[model samples]
Every structure is written in structure tokens, then in C-alpha cells.
Target: MSNQQPGWFPDPSDAKKMRWWDGNEWAVHVSRDGAVWEEPLVAKTIGLKRRSRWVWVLLALGLLVAVALLSPLVALVALVVLVTGIVGISKGSGTWLRLKSRRTAIGVTAGAALVFLMAGSVSAAMVPGETGAPTAVETAQSAEARSEATPRRTSTPTPTPVTTSREEVVTEVIPFERSTVEDANIARGETTISVSGQDGERTITYVVTVVDGVETGRELKSDVETVAPVTEVTTVGTYDAPPEPAPPAEPTCDSNYADACVPIASDVDCAWGSGNGPAYFDGVAKVVGRDIYGLDRDGDGLACER
Candidate 1:
């Protein structure tokens, strides 16, 4: 109301203002919100359309039913139906299926049915399908979990065979605790090799050739002759040299000519001559004289046996 008031705000008395020391000049409007409040040139309009979810839903289900009626043909028709439904219905675009209003439902359904029928009647169509695929990742994960949960036992393997031979030799010599043996001489024929040693390390490999039981000569593998607390039985006798290694018995029948009933000849081994007996070989044994004359041509027992 004062005529002498500074022209700072519309109503200087009623307005909230921050007077600042602008260093060299007075600051103008200092509020951040006061920068710009542009006028909206054009207004947006949202058309009021009814909930067309039932519309899209009905359309998708109808398509599915039609497809069931027409297997392969249903595919192209179904695809066209989906696209048409999407374009025709504005409200149900983002929905999983389509719905139509009582008003729009008739048109939507008719368009869908017409297109579906045309596509189906004209051509064979291919359909996208899912079958025989490997199980889902979750299923596989479940199987893995089951396997991990089950208790498992592992089996131990049998040991492989180990072998040792007599004709072994060594070069380096090791000294052993010298132990003396009672000098009792006995006659011997051949020799027996007795080995003695430390816990694991063989200290002696003394093979003495004894005639009967008396020592004639000796051979050593390693030098540390650990004469174990051995009760040495020196024999003045001979061992029966394995009874001269018995000879092998002669074979009664040739392995290649094996047959209980036939002599080695033709396939039948049948009666070859006018008076010859039936010559054949079965697996069973045949006695020459016992079998019928026509039965045993090869002198085997059975007659005409093949």
C-alpha cells in the first residue's frame, strides 16, 4: 500500500523474498521453481474403451478350438487370427489373449473365423511344436541333487601278481654281524640255497652246493651273509631227482581227425564200397566189432550215424 515501496514483487508486503548481497548488483527472481513453467501447447486424449480382455480371451480360445478341429491347417490360420485380433482390438494388445466387447466381439470373432477358414481350406500349414526335448534345467538340477544326497560306497581292487626268480646278482658288498656255525660236517649230493637278511633288507644270499648234506661249494648274491639262527641239518644222502621227469603219454586219437563214429575220409564217411558198412561220425564213441557191419564202415561203433 506504500507508494514509496520498491517494485520487487506483485505484492511486496505479502510476498516472501530473499534479499541478497549480489556483490555488485541486485539478484532478480531467486527461486529454482520460478525458472520456467511452460504452457502445454497440446492436450493428450485417452479414448474410453471398455475392458476388452474378455474379447481377446474369447478370440485366442476360439483360435485354439479351431486349430484342434484342423491340425496342420490351423497353424497359418491361427497366426493370422492372432495378428488380426491384435490389430483390431486396441485395449487387449499387451494381454496374453484377446477379449471382445459385446459390440466388438461379433466383428472380431467373424474376422478371425473367416480368415481361419480360408487359410485352412486352401493350404496345408506347418505348426511349431515341442516334443521329445531334453528335460528342463530344473529337472536336471533335481536329478543332480538326488545323486548327491544318496550315500555311495567305492570298491577296492584286487592286488596284481608279484613274482621273484632265483638268478639275481648284486655288486656292492655290505658287512653283516658275523655269526659262527658249529662245524659239523656231513656228506651231501646237491645243494640248497637259504637266504637270510635284516627285517626287510636281505643280508645273505648263500647258496651252498652240498653233496648229500655236506657242503661242497657255495655261491653268494649279496655279501652281508646274515647266517640266521638256522638249525642246519646237513644230509649225507641224495634226493630222488624228481623220478626222472616222467615221459608224456602218447595220444590215442588224432585231434584233427576227432570223431567217435567215423574214419577220416569223405564228409559222410559213409559206406564207400558195395560191402562196406555205413561210414559216419556222430559225437558218441563207436566200437568197431560191436557195431553192425553196415553201421561201422570206419570200424567205429555206430551204424549210419552222422
Candidate 2:
């Protein structure tokens, strides 16, 4: 094995696996059946190994270069490694330390320090210098220079002229006229419409003045009757009726006669007795006063007695 070149060789601890040997030492990289993985070489004794200070210095330089070219995640990994190394050194023994080696502790601490230093250097390099940033006065001067480079022209707006226009408009309206007629058949003070009146239409023209889409004024241009107005006819009643004849007066008995209602006529006689008469009296008649009808022939006041 000492004379063999750096290559995959059979693992000493496990014959079924193959391990990688660098020029100086065995690497943690291993492979089996074409598959590759990492596994630290087991130490024969659980004792710490001694390493020269130069090894630690070289590892620190390598980590610094890696951190400078890689991302911040690499820096964080280095910090964890450094913390683990410190804790292991304080406890004098730690399960995390491979082979419990003091050399690994020193290498991790130095590498973490170098990584931080390189990260700070990279940050400082990316920052802009004071002279590189523009000041307020310089910015103003540059803007003035740009303004002077181009000449600006001022534009004036033209005023709009006020215009007027006239438009003719035609409108239609309904109109009607009413007139009365005398009718003999209708009674006086009682009128009735003989004919139904209808509405008529008239057309009118107007001239309007408009300025800038707005109406200013309008004037009557012409008016013409399109349809003649219909006249409304009204009938009035006028009738005079003749006076009615008075009813006949009731006949009354003469005051000169008593105990009988004698007929008031030019001549009267007893109902069944004999005498020329225009009227007759039933039963006998007695006269208390003058006998106007001559119903009593005796001179006594009481005539036709018994």
C-alpha cells in the first residue's frame, strides 16, 4: 500500500468496500459497486493524533479562498465547525470529533477565522468609495449641463373664435273655436250641443340663434293655419206654455135658505114638486131670510113649512 499510487483501493477495515487514497493520506471518499460516498477512516485507537502547525496554516488558507469565491452559506458552515472545535477542546472529549483528534480542532478554528476575514474583505471590496458617490452640488451641475445642451421652445395656444348660427324650426299645435246656434226645438234656459267639436292643428315657424352648440335666442318667423278650427254648436231651448184654466168653483147653498141646500141657479124648484126650474132642491126648504130662489111662497120668514 505504501508504494501504490493514489486511487481506489480495497478498504482495510471492510473488504467489500473500496476507499480513495490521496497522495499523502486516505481520503474520506469511498465507493462500492460503482456508487460513491464519504466515510471517515476509522482509527485503530481512540487517541488523538499530532499534526504540524504548517498543516493548520495550509487548511486556513484553503478555507479563506473557498469562502471568498463561494456564498455566505460556506461562511456559516465554517462558523459551526469552529464552534464545535471550541466545545470539543473545552470538554477534552466529544463524540462529534472524528478520531477525537486535536489536529482537527486546530484546523477547524483556523479555517473559520480565515473564512470570516475573507468574507469581510469581499464586503469591503463591494462598497463604493466616498469619491465615487456624487454630491448634491455635482448632481445639480450635471442637470444644468444637460438642460443647456438642449434648447427649449415655448408654445402659445390659439384662442377659439365665437361663432353664431340661425336655424329654423317648425312646430305644430292644436286649436279649436266654439260658436253657439239658436234652436227652436230646445226649451228656453235649456241648451244642448247639436254638433261635436274637434280639435284643429296649426303650424308655426321659429328662427333660433345658436352660438357654440348652445341656443342664444329665438324669434317667431311665420305662423300658418294648417287645419281649420271646428266650431262648437250649442242648442238653446225657448218655449212658453199657455196658462192653465182655473178649476170650477164649488156650489154653495144660499144664506137666505135654511134646512136645505138649494141649487144655485136662475130658477129652482122642489125635487119632486112642480115648477119650471133650471135646478131642483131635495126635500123641503125653509127660508130664514130673503128667499132668493122663491123656494118659499108664503110671506112668513119660515117658508115651505111642513
Candidate 3:
């Protein structure tokens, strides 16, 4: 679940021991001494438990065979070791086991395996032959014969030395970094620099290591920022929406009289010359609906003929 690799990790179920994280899922294998295995004591309802039980049975049979063949003292020690290993496997399912890196767990497992092999070898040596034990002379002759039967390996040739030139680095003061501050009152999608930024100069010395005319490593020896960087102030726009237009006013005689040019009660002259007069009225009293306020008393269509 975490970035931790597939290996021994502190068990979420139990704090005292480690559990195996198989990259994607938590495996049944748990360990107290870096010897991880699926728990045997778990219920058979689990598929992993059923599979792991077979492995345990095979190991038990192997130990029994070793016990039957080896001498009493050797067999007793092997049996004790085998039993201890089994007990270790059963003890708390890794309660008190600390998590170790995969590399460390691997090393520990390799060491334990080496010890097991050595114990088995000792048991084999202690095993009694069917015939009487071989005499020292016969033992020596057998060892000689075996040595002669095996072929000896020739010595390997030394590798040729490679020619390479050492790398060198030349350092000088140069510009490095600059910072910027924002101002949000400007119009959206617009940017303006308030204060210009100046990059700081740094004096650095480096050691470049090369092999076979190819650069291999570059390490800094000295770095001194001679000038401090100047921060640049910038104004960025925040207002983006367009403003709304005002609504139109209602048309009336006082507001739109110039456009209407209709004869009203305030008209003093025949033509009502204060504002622009109607252009289409004929030279006669006009009849518009039931009102006749613009009475020319003449038959012309112009209601207020001058």
C-alpha cells in the first residue's frame, strides 16, 4: 500500500513482528527471526494455509529421515535444531520480530541455511558405515583417488589495464536565480512587471572525474553566492467579466417630445416652435383617435399650421 518494497515490514495486524509484503498484497508469511513462512496454525479455510501445510509436512519428513540415519548424538542435535526451527515458526507468528530490509533478510536466511547444511554434513560424517569404519590408511587412499578423479582448473589470465585521462572543471561566477511577487489588481490575462529581477552571481569550483576520456563524476568543491537575487514584482489581472449595459427608459411626451413632435396642451404658437415640429402633418386640423387638441379650424391635414 505504501512505497515500501516487497519484503519484511511491520505487520499491521501485530506490532511485535514482521509480515511479508509481496509488492501488491500482504502475504501469509510472517517472521520472528527473518525466517518467513505461512502460518501453520491458521485455519484450513484459507487456501494459502492448505498449500503451506504441505510444505511443512515435507520438511517434517525430511527431518525424520535425517534423525533415522544420523548417530544418536548428531541426530539429537539435529532434532533439537529442527524442533527449535519449528517452534520459532509457531511462536506468536512473528510476535517480537522486527522488520528488516530485503537484503538483510536475505543475508540472514543464507546464514541460517549455511548452518543447516553444516549440521547435516556433520550428521553425515558421524553416520556409521555398514562395515567397520575405514582405517586411516584406507581413508587417505580414498581421498587421494577422489582428488585424482577430479580435474583441476587452470589459472585465469590478468585483465589488461585501460588508459584514461583525468577530467577537469573550470568554474566562474555566473547568474543563478531570481524570485517574483504577484499583484492581482491587473486585468485578467494580462501581466506587467513592476520590479525587474536580477539574477544573482555565484562562484563555484567543481572537481570533474573522467575515465577513458569520458566524464564520470562532477562534485562541487566551493559555492559562494556573490550577489543576492532581486525579487521581481508583477501585477496580474483578476477582473475578467464584461460590465452590463443600462436598461432603456420608457418613452413619454416630456422625454421623447422632440421625436414625437405631436401637438400637446403646452403649445402656444400654431406650429409649437419650441422643439422640432412634426414633418408629415398637413395644413389642416388633424383627427387622431377621439382627441382634437391640435384644432387648425381649417380643412388642411396639418394640425398646427404656422
Candidate 4:
């Protein structure tokens, strides 16, 4: 019958234990393995007999009678005592008395009813509306519930700013220039360096600004240190050339062929012939190659005509 009521019963998940059924649904509280009820730690194994409802009814009747006869103070004290006894018997003795015997269970419930009647008489003697406050335990539990329901607070973080700079080095070439000067001693179309040219050098430093690990701005910080340039001197050839020696005189044809030449036209002068006055030749073969005297009547290389 108690199991059929709107309360707890042995859990289906664990047959040896009890779980709370809060009238409409099962609650989170569950008993240990051998427990018969789910409740406060000290009373979890105790079972409240369904008949305990009769104890509360008896308490109410006793309180009514005491309030009508005795004062309100007496009635209030009696009310407190009755409520305490009912809770203890229902939670502590209910399961134990029932399991031992039905007779024992009935005896305990009747005894608690009688105690409530006796205390109700004394509480009814107190003044009306002057009942004592709730017990310390109930007040403490209320405070604990309020604390758990309240939310906690958190702090906000602040941001910090930063400044940064960077330095970098780079190099570049300075070109050297060539300079020319006239040199009459040098030959034309020829180049000679009176002084060799040299390239100039320089170095510079800069200050650069960076933000969040990235470059943002830059400026020159140091004056450029420069090496002065050495002026180059190159001699361009401007010398005039001496006139080429007069080409040698051409040789004369008379000098190259003097053996064949004749200044006097005498037949004796003919070197190829031996005759003198007539410049005669017995045969043309005898006058071969000696016509310088012009004594040949025909060009047969003969000296004279027949």
C-alpha cells in the first residue's frame, strides 16, 4: 500500500535499493544497496508506514482541544512537540517497527499519538500569535539555498600598447668618372693615362620604424661619410707626324738597259757584230741581236743589207 502511494519505492534499476518518486516523477535521490527509503543521510534506510498519516490527524485534534481550553502559548509548545515526534516516528521507526511485527508497528504509532496529545495541552497554555521562530537547522538550509541560486562575477582584462623600431644596412656602388687632357708628346690616335682614376666610396645609416613586427617608416639618421674622388687625368694623343721621307726617285729606262743603248750610230759600235765600215754580214745569222746601229734593212736581226 505504501509503495502504491505518491512517494518512493524500490528502484527498478537496483531492486535492493529505493529511489524517490516525487508524486509526479522520479527525483535524483537514490538509497544505498540495503536502504528502504531515499532521504536525509541519517534516515535514508527508514520507511514511513502509510498509517503514519493517522498520527498527524490525532495531533491536529489534540491541538484543537488544547487551544480551546488552555492559553495560546501552551498550544504553540504542544504544536512543536507533536510535529517533532511525528517526523521522528515516521522516518526513524517506521521501517524497523513494520519489519519486526505489525503489533510492534501499531504499538509505536499509538504511543507517539498519546505523546502529541500530552504536549498539545502544554502548548495551548501559551499566548496567541507568540509562537517561537523556526529552528536553527531550517534557517541555515534556507540561507544555503539562496547562496547556491546567486551568480558569481568576473573581471575584465585591459589592453597594453607597444612601440618598436628597426635598423637595416644596404650598400651601393659610386661610379668613377674619366677626365682627358691634351699631350703633344703622345702620338695621334693613341691614348695615354697621365693619372689613373679611382672610384669613390660612401656609407649611410637609417632609422626605421616598425609596428606589430612589420615595417612602417624609415629616415636617414647619419650624414653620408664619403671618400673624396681622385680626379682622373687622361692624355689624348695630339702630336703632329713628321712628313714621310720623299719616295725614292724612279729609276730611268736608259740606266736599266744601257747594254742595248747606243749614243753614236756607228756600225762598229754594234756590240753583237765584228765588222767595221760597211757593217756587212755575210749571213743574217751572223747579225743575231746587234741592230742598235739601225744597219738592218729588215728586222731579221741582221746588221746590214746585202
Error of 2 at 162 (Å): 7.3
Q: Give a tens-digit lDDT track for model 2, residues 1-306.
A: 667789988877677899998866788998998999998876433223334455656766776677777735665675556555555554555537563477767666565655655664565566546245443335334544654554555578977856676757575756666778776666679888877787877778787877677888889888887887677888777775668999998868776787777767887776666777778777776677778776666666554443
lDDT tens string, model 4, 207-253? 88977677788998775647756778888999999999999976432
- lDDT digits (tens) for residues 118-213 of candidate 3: 554555576645446443335334545654555655689987645444434454545434445454566678877777867766677677766656
lDDT of 1 by residue, 1-306 (tens): 234344333322213433222344333433223552322211111121233556667866776666666645664545444444444343333233344353454465455555555444433334335445332233334544654565555579977544333433443334333232322242235443333433223355655565544556667755553433433343233434335777997664323332453453323334433433234444544453433234445554445545
Off by over 4 Å in 1: 1-43, 46-100, 124-306
Q: State in Å the error of residue 211, model 2.
A: 3.0
* Full-model lDDT for every candidate: 0.43, 0.67, 0.52, 0.54
Candidates in order, TM-scores: namely 0.14, 0.34, 0.23, 0.31
User: Model 2 TM-score?
Assistant: 0.34
For model 4, state the Cα shift of residue 214 in Å.
3.8
Off by over 4 Å in 4: 1-158, 166-172, 251-306
lDDT for 72 in candidate 3 is 47
Whole-model alpha-carbon lDDT for candidate 2 = 0.67
* lDDT-best of 2 and 4: 2
Best by lDDT: 2
lDDT over C-alpha atoms for residue 158 of model 3: 80
lDDT of 3 at 195: 78
Lowest lDDT block of 10, candidate 4: 253-262
